[model samples]
Target: MRKIAASLAVLVATTTPASAQNAVDWFGVDGLEFASPATSFRFTDLDLRDPHVFLPITIAPFPTICFDFTDNAIPTTTVSFNGNIQASYNSDSSPADGFLDASSLLWFRPLAQDGRVARVDNGGADCLAPAPTSGCAPSATAVATAYAYASFAAGTCLSSLPGTQGSPAYAPAIASPAGSCFVTAPKTFVFDNNGTPLTLIDAQIAASFNGVPATALSNGLLRGFLRESDANQIVISDPALPGGSVTLAGPAGRRQRQLFHAQRQGHAPGRERLVVLFQLQRVPGDLHRPLSAFGDHVRFTEDTR
Candidate 1:
């Protein structure tokens, strides 16, 4: 009996799928867009002329990369490209600890109006159009499938579970017209002959604001983007960094109005609060052009540092 049980256990172990052993699920929106550019509000600025940027974000929490999953009849509706799973999550959006917290799922083509999660699957169903050769996803190597991002704000009320959304010292998706910290510093720069930036620094760092006082640093509204120090919204290749070097540049993402975002919060007297509108990411071209990823609606967490 022991021998037989041992053999069965080995068979069961071999037959079990690898995914069954995992516990972590990774789905973070690496970069987001919120509002139109400076030239927005014009009727003609339909955002149709820009090249779409589909960034494949990778989070280290889970072993596998984040992919799309549609559970039926839940508030997590990341529906699209048509297999059209009937699922939804309770997208009752509101602020939690000053930041935008909700259950909005993301889908390509139409922007998300509810839910908190954003998902991306390898596009496949687009090939199943009436013409048979729809050239979508797997059928075509490169498909310009545009997706709608989550829109949030510095919500007035708190979410049901305010404790879950962990408040970090430095949070993102927040900016301000008041401090204009980014405008005052020399954060943005052009690429030199060696494919390296002339000067790259963070907008949030204290030293960047050389003339500003400690009271301002301690109490001012700052750009909450964690990567603003090196990787701005308009990402590019830098030879100086270990893996940021860009050998060949591809077509740039729509530089105009791809900024999607939401979240903002009040700061403590000696801490930081966010005031930006939202988040956005443009392509790797034109690093010299100053772009701030349109800022952040931001849950402004108090950055103690």
Candidate 2:
């Protein structure tokens, strides 16, 4: 009987699928969007005209293992395509941890040529180990790591959770406007290489603003957005605003708005380019530190084309 029981245990453990092993029923937020040099708001050297970027995000109730479940039990809603799932966490009923996790799954991979969801299995480098050289290889540890990330991300977004949301030194929301803010900086660059008429291929913005003082004013009314229509809204005042301006990038997300234009640099339209800028402002007098002076501008531009 002991032998039979041991055999049964082995069978059960081995037969249990990876997805089922990690299943802990939960909810999260997600988003998807088109990212391209043409529509990129971030800085880059490429001139993206018809570039494309697929952004998907996930927000879990708690940190969780980052693995794809084989079961079809998961159901989700499209929060927004602008890659602003964190904003959805804020405006929606979900706990506001300003990041994405397994629960809050956002799909970043672009769709297939036929416009179907691009199916890439979650067997690559996750929150756990490095991506496999081959395809994704599921592991118990990897799933657990994904779960941890989900939990931490959810905690980071929750306003009610102390030391989790917008308060204090290490807090993302309190430290930097871009920290808790999740908006895809998409930009389009038009260049005139001394009237050579050349356009680059793509762009990206990697930013981190730190050491920002979180006073009382930076709290209450400082959460308001500076819309394009706002009197003090920063305009595309650059002498090189692209003539083929798009009316609006995408729908103004719940807590997000479209702000400015991107420009390429050169003696006429040189090799490098400048990315567009978006500002999250404080109500008049609500901030003690000048935003332009407070945080360090840690931004990077990449081409994903």
Who wins the TM-score comparison?
Answer: 1
| Shift in Å, residue 296, candidate 1 | 40
User: TM-score of each candidate?
Assistant: 0.16, 0.16
How much does candidate 1 score in TM-score? 0.16
Q: Provide the overall lDDT of each model, using Cα atoms, as 2-decimal numbers.
A: 0.18, 0.18
- For candidate 2, give the lDDT of residue 102: 13
Q: Score residue 180 of candidate 1 by CA lDDT.
A: 14
Give lDDT tens digits, candidate 1, residues 184-267: 111221212222332222222110111222111111111222222222333322223225422212112221112211122332
In Å, residue 133's CA in model 1 sits off its true spot by 59
Per-residue C-alpha lDDT of model 2 across residues 1-305, encoded as one tens digit per residue: 11111111100001111232212122332212222111001100111111011111236775432221111112253222112212221132222222111111111233122212221111111111111111111112211000011111110111111111111211112222123212122222122211222222222221222223211111110111112232112111111222311112222111122112122112122122222212111111221111122123311122222
Q: Number of clashes in every candidate structure?
A: 43, 54
Off by more than 4 A, model 2: 1-51, 55-274, 277-280, 286-305
What is candidate 2's local distance difference test score? 0.18
lDDT of 1 at 99: 15
